[model samples]
Target: MPTDASNFSVTMVIRSILYTTQQASESPYNYVPTEWVCIFFLTAYSISTAIHMGQALRYKLWWMIPTVTFAGILEIFGWSCRLWSSQSPELLRPFEMQLFGTILAPTPLVAAYFIIFGRITIHFGPQFSRLTPNMYIIVFFSLDTICLTIQAVGSVFAAEAVNEYKSPTLGGNIMLGGISAQLFAIWVYLGLAAEFFLRRKYNAPFRRQVIKFGKGQRSMSKDVQCMIYALGFCTICIIIRSVYRTVELADGWSGTVISTESYFNWLDGGFVVVAMYTLNVIHPGIYLKSVDTSLPDEDKVNLSYVF
Candidate 1:
């Protein structure tokens, strides 16, 4: 039903969009991604995921089945997409796959950490915690899910804008806001967790258990200490990664931080690798095995707290 002039105008608009992609100056990533690096991460994630699955099954840690295992799978998929993108830098599909996979992968890992903290709260004694074990899981998990949704929605808008040759400012701001919120949430969680320990340290009325170690001391088990340490370490790693991501996103897609593979390799991918491997070495399932077995079925510290 369009006249010839209208059809010509439509053609011109399409041509303009197409022309943007063909420009040498334009690329989703400013530089071609390194193939070997992508493969390395993919292989590492594959191994880590395999180990997590085996540990979860052997320990019957059904709660972790959905959290840690799922997170590793996401990392694998994301790196695989990165590997594909290295081969075809011009393709948007692979870039998007990697972008989303990497962005959302950490969410489950963070959730798993939250669940573990809840269990720790129970193991020590619910009396020391300001929030109930169930509430800890519920409140933080909800915050994490909300943050993830915001990032995802923002990514979709940004991608669409890129495809249309439009400025991605609005979408980028949304993403920045989401990641920033996530960073703030992590800090708050750390604060609460630290407060829990401090309460036990000072509040004599609430101090039911004292963890002692080293010099012929008799108190909390070694594995429990290790588990707590591992949780803290993994959390630190997540914080580092989160901070880096916030900065990278803030700089925008064309920003130097996003353009350089080295920064991402070390700050983003490197931190995640360390966290995942650290979990493998000090797995909650193995370390917390005694807690699970010692507690009565009804009193077990697991995801049943969710319901």
Candidate 2:
């Protein structure tokens, strides 16, 4: 009887220890366990985005290829970090993974946005608007860069604080705010781009005529429609992620955020990643003029013969 009692006591102690460790490791802010779910979605997203990016490269869509590639890589890395966190939630390194991923991933999306805006201006004729295509790219991307820089700096600061004091500090808040501002900028930019496209489409009699041609017109409209859809979807995904992040960090690591890991997974990993991969399915290259035939006949023949 004494032997059985001793074994039971030992088992209880071990279980208690495990439970305490788990509780300690859990994010104080979250109410649900979602690390595994986040990892799964992010991993899937990364793979899909990578595949699409490869397709973009295959078509020589130079501007978009790099952006998609960057986003894919960052997402994979970020998810890997999340996975690591799930394994050992007490470790601070996982936070660094998330920080880098969050900071770098959005840059490509911003770049993609710039390209779309530039294309719209060119399509409509730059003279029709006060802003030049190049100016739009320069101004918006510059602002994006600034926001990224601030978020990065804030993340680094937060990491440093965590490492030194074993707690998150004001840096996290700063980073959160920076990301929120970026989200705002993205929405504003999207609104402007949508307005520009609508106005331009409305004014273009040739495009309007082409649309009235029925089945054949579908091919002509596909590219423009895809571009608009991709941009709008990306903007919405980013905005949702940003809002979640703001809420997550609102308490500045004091643990007020609910469903942290799961929310990040669904909003950031799943949605953003899926939206990015969608770009590959409807790549602008499919609609843009063929690169091989861009040159004059003489040049094309010479180039083909040389190859």
Candidate 3:
């Protein structure tokens, strides 16, 4: 491996050469991520998506297909781009592709997590919830959409940035803002979920009725139990991912932590991948049976990728 200075100087020379030749300008720096790590995540997320697809189709989970499908696609494709950059570090295209794709990939996955809460609440009877089950899907997901769009737009701007020549601060700040918004949204959603569970656990309205209704869940079924566990685990996993993004982005786009591939794989990629697989194994679609199609249109996917 060449020294950092040599690597940078070579990149500068290449950029200058491209400029003189009137060729498309490229980023002067190459990330050069480890190939094995990229392959590992790509393969894992792909298999997870395939399994989730089978389960979704088996249970007719139309609402979840968009969220699950897009996340898997984005993660797999983003990692593939990383593989490209590792092989040919001088090319700028792969870096641009991975930048926004990987960052925006988890947005839909987090939406899936938010949807699970609403469904679980409905299963247990929304009356025990501090807010209606509908509220969870409507409010939190709207916030999710905002966060997703902001981050995506910010990434686009960042990708257009010329390394060592242009400032990425504007785009970086927008991305950071989106991440901040997501952190707030998920934390609030978690608080609501915790409140609902506690309210049901303690002496609250419908406490006695809810207990007698299902004989403490014998009537509600095992799927309900599974949904509870799945939701809890998924929340924790995604929270770790969001926190990682927030901290990593705060350090600036080219900060040491963000520049380190291993750390990112462990925190961002690892956290979301575990959550996706865990959700697949404990699939709510397997147990949810049938949701009311008559429920507000916003709750269903209906071709909306972000919601």
Candidate 4:
């Protein structure tokens, strides 16, 4: 039989081997993230952020400046972390930073969209909207705040669990709840958007109101129309991204959705890239003018007034 000291040494060697094996087996990203892909995203976000800052400054789009800039910066940071993670896939810090940064980045961007839609409603006429222009911002932004909080807290727990080399089921579930709530809010917002458009198209009195920068009764300016179309496209892309994230988290950390990097590259990263660039091409600052504040609000129908 081995002496006690030798036995202890043997046991320590076995434990060391097992610990290394566990570390090797537990990758935050099941597959190593592609380096080139991460670089592409990082570069793209950096350029877009520069463009957004210039536009916001030029047009004095004070409301959009912070939200869009913040989103772009977060995206840049996240992608940079991803690039670092690709190099050091075994490291926990990069994974934690990328995961938290990417997940939370879009929240501000989505808030910017809400504000855009609210401004659009005001531009067309708030009376045509079901919940009024301001209510759209109020209701959706409040829900967004709640969801953001949930997601932030959940991400911390998930990161801790990952550090401890345990299953992130509880944290994942919490994140799912938050993301699911966000999805529901997006759907409802779409419904309200539909209602606003339908009301504007079919409502007789509003149709007769003098159209802005257009000759015909129902015609909107080409710029406004383009802005509206761009907003719609962005909304669709965001929906796709949100759905992808929701499903990814729902399938647990070790599941197929998270295991495959392609789904994330396309559904999550691709969609957002498309959306951000689409906005850059058809920028709201250039296409969408300020709401005509001179117009009377006597006919406005707010949710507060209804209740």
Instruction: Give the residue spans of candidate 2 off by over 4 A.
Output: 1-35, 125-130, 201-220, 289-307
Task: Decide which is better by lDDT, 1 or 3.
Answer: 1
Tens-place lDDT per residue, model 1, 1-307, is 8999999999999998776545324458776678899999999989998999999999888777678888899899889988887777777777777777888788888888899989887766555666777888999999988988888888777777777778777777887788888888889889888888877666532333242212322134789889989999999998999999889988988888988889998988899888999999999888887765555454442322221
What residue pairs are clashing in model 3?
none
For residue 127, model 2's alpha carbon misses the true position, in angstroms, by 4.3
- Residue 214 of model 1 has an lDDT of 20
lDDT of each: 0.80, 0.64, 0.74, 0.79
Model 2 lDDT tens row, 1-307 = 5798899999999999887566655643232235667567676766777776777778777777667677777777777776666666667678566667865686677677677667655443343334556767887878787887878788888888776765656777778777877877777777666666555556532122211212221122455666767767777777777777777777557564534555565666667766776666656666554422333455323311110
* Candidate 2 lDDT: 0.64
Off by over 4 Å in 1: 1-26, 204-219, 295-307
Q: Report the candidate with higher TM-score, 3 versus 4.
A: 4
Worst 10 residues of 1 by lDDT: 209-218
Please identify model 4 stretches exceeding 4 Å from their true place. Answer: 1-26, 204-219, 290-307
What is the C-alpha RMSD, rounded to one decimal, of candidate 3? 8.5
Sort order, lDDT high to low: 1, 4, 3, 2
Clashing pairs in 1: none
- Candidate 3 colliding pairs, count: 0
Estimate the lDDT of model 1: 0.80
